[model samples]
Target: MAQAGTFVFLDYYGRLAIERGFVKPEAEDEDENGEALPSTSGAAKPKVPTISHSAALIEDLTAHKTAALRVELANNPDVALVAVVHAMLLSVAYPYNSEQSALQLTLTPERLEPSMKNAESCKGLSAFNDLADNYGHHLPGNPAELFDWLLEQPQDIVLSLLAFGAAHSVNAVEKKFTDRKKGIEQANQLGRALKVNMPDWFETTGDSYFKHVNRMTIELSLAEARGSEAELSVRAAAKKSEAVTIADRLVAGTGWIPSPLRIAPSEAEQELGAESIAEDEQFPQAAE
Candidate 1:
């Protein structure tokens, strides 16, 4: 019974055998009906199911479909953009009825208020609010008229609205329990394309950065921004709070951006490097 793959059927058959008195229960070790029952303490474990033939076939078929769809979508950027906009609108405007959009993409706009201290007073938030308000003023007051209004709008207007929606959809916030490396990588790609200068938008201070990090991190930041002398100065501060204050004062007006906040290397640079490597391989340099 243990050798068979169907453990459930074995359990059923074992119960039936016990009811008919063919086999005795383990508790009745000294039953006179038959020889002493063997101990079940080292029973054979059930076998785990591997990939089935049907499952493998389905996977192969779906892979072909996925590849074909990807090619079609890549060739039709206009359709892809529209699909993205439609998906985003469904997520933002009709969250409960998001299944209306055919696209499987999900856009969850991160709420920064809960995570960031003094988020309400943030300059970036203020700018975003202004943009939202400007768009809101142009939009229809009635929810029913929104679709018609959007349809009647110029292509540029529609694009502007789409950009706003896409911008809000961006989520680069790192969480404790989840690995969001792929999301962060995509965000960095977007940043590089936009030539984003982080220092222009955000000024790192005790409240924003230093207070959140440990004393060592603060010292390291100072060392990078100023020098080893500045690092030593911060280290002299006995308490972490004192170190944070000293570091903040020293780092101010330095236009120093944290490593995480810095823009990633552009795609063009990566392509150029790859090309250079290929050329180098084709024509090896002669060593002097």
Candidate 2:
């Protein structure tokens, strides 16, 4: 049971009502249309973390500044982004400030309730409560949405105010699952990998694809896999990336996922290539 039923305070408020689980916003509860419907009976309620100092913490993440982040948490532990990140930072805060600055550490989560009542008054609580526990990566809405956007944005976006584990979503990881730009299509190739050992929980409905990957990537992938060869309805236009996606899938299923692409050539590789070229250019001892 939660230590407290849910806090009713100035900065924080809500009733977790864990018995029913976490209910997302009406928008989150909506279907493809703008229409909203009541959830059916006996569905698992999602979990969302509760915390305080939400405004400052979210600002720190949105601003994407590490120093500012450290300061925010240092000044107020309750400002932590999510449980995982909070857990991590708590283990590393300080004695290193040579200047012995005015940092007063507090238990980040201590300031918030595991549950709250009437969350509306809270500034950022609802926006980020889902991220409070280690489960922040599992956003209530389209799970692939934020991560899909992240792929197009600079890598630094990962370090933005999400704090701690906010950036560690399955979707975030899927984007970096393979080499070069192939990572962008990692979701399309996921079914191939999953075929090796399907998850008991996985249900291959249309929504499954949307939950894990962007639309275009999945469509392009299906086109290659089942288009002309299998006569399945191809969903999108042709993409030259078909080969790269296939290769990535093959590599992914083999218990091997390549590391991020190296942008700069290593010194040894540079020298070896040059040496090989030089040797090829040389005549072999006048054929003696």
Candidate 3:
């Protein structure tokens, strides 16, 4: 699989092996008898002491907290939207005063052309570009004149522009050797708010998804989307290529998206306020 050669995959597999005790590091400066050898320089070696938490455990705990935070933030879109706008404006209009933005959110838009072939042809990209062009035509050409132009615009227009800019700043793309869990959680929150339907935008075919992954992944996806019968059909294929084809045909129009791409269902807006009030009453300090 093409993904297997990536640094993320390699690092994940290596860490998994270490965590499962399938591999162990060799001790330094020792014989098979488990005795310490003399220092080659005849100098004393300083004692090193250490205390560390399990990286896996910490990651698990923090992930739960991050999920909770995302849910709470999503419950209050009015505040979240304002924070996003404030952060975006500070970064662009007042770069030197960026620290004043309480959110401390950094927006670095990623270019997908290098990684995804024909990325410019994507419908989403085309729509975004058209929106950007429309805004460009209305905005002042000179950077210095932009502030005055923004001030002249109505509240709705300004808010629309703010939303557009904030949307552009979203960076949900994952990278090799990088952690994007928090970014992804926020993106999912935004997706839920917008009621994004991935099936409406993209289709998963052999070229799009199945062919790139291993046969097992294809089988698993087929199982989830089309049931055990479809998975068995794929598994019975003589070659991985054939399996991919079978999977592609079987899963077409099933409206089944990979777990990573699916957005979590949001809680009822009417109940969110009540839940927050109850939590505040139960833990006043935490609410503060």
Candidate 1 lDDT, 97-152, residue by residue in tens: 56765568877788777867788768878898888778767765554455556666
**TM-scores, one per candidate:** 0.60, 0.17, 0.55
How far residue 201's Cα lies from its native spot in candidate 1, in Å, is 1.8
Off by over 4 Å in 3: 1-106, 115-118, 265-288
lDDT of 1: 0.74
Worst 10 residues of 3 by lDDT: 1-10
**Which number leads on TM-score?**
1
At residue 97, give the lDDT of candidate 2.
Answer: 26
Worst 10 residues of 2 by lDDT: 255-264
Which predicted model would earn the best lDDT? Answer: 1
Q: All candidates' lDDT scores?
A: 0.74, 0.39, 0.70
Q: What is the lDDT of residue 155 in candidate 1?
A: 71
For 1-288, candidate 2 gives per-residue lDDT tens digits of 112133223333543233323343332355667576575334564444456568888897766776766777667533332322333333223213212222243322222223323335443344445445534343323322433433354434334433433222323122324453554445335534445233232223232232245545555544443455321233322542443344334333233211221122445767999998899888455664
How far in Å is the alpha carbon of 58 misplaced in model 2? 42
Q: Which pairs in model 2 have colliding backbones?
A: 14-116, 14-117, 15-116, 15-117, 61-161, 77-108, 85-164, 131-136
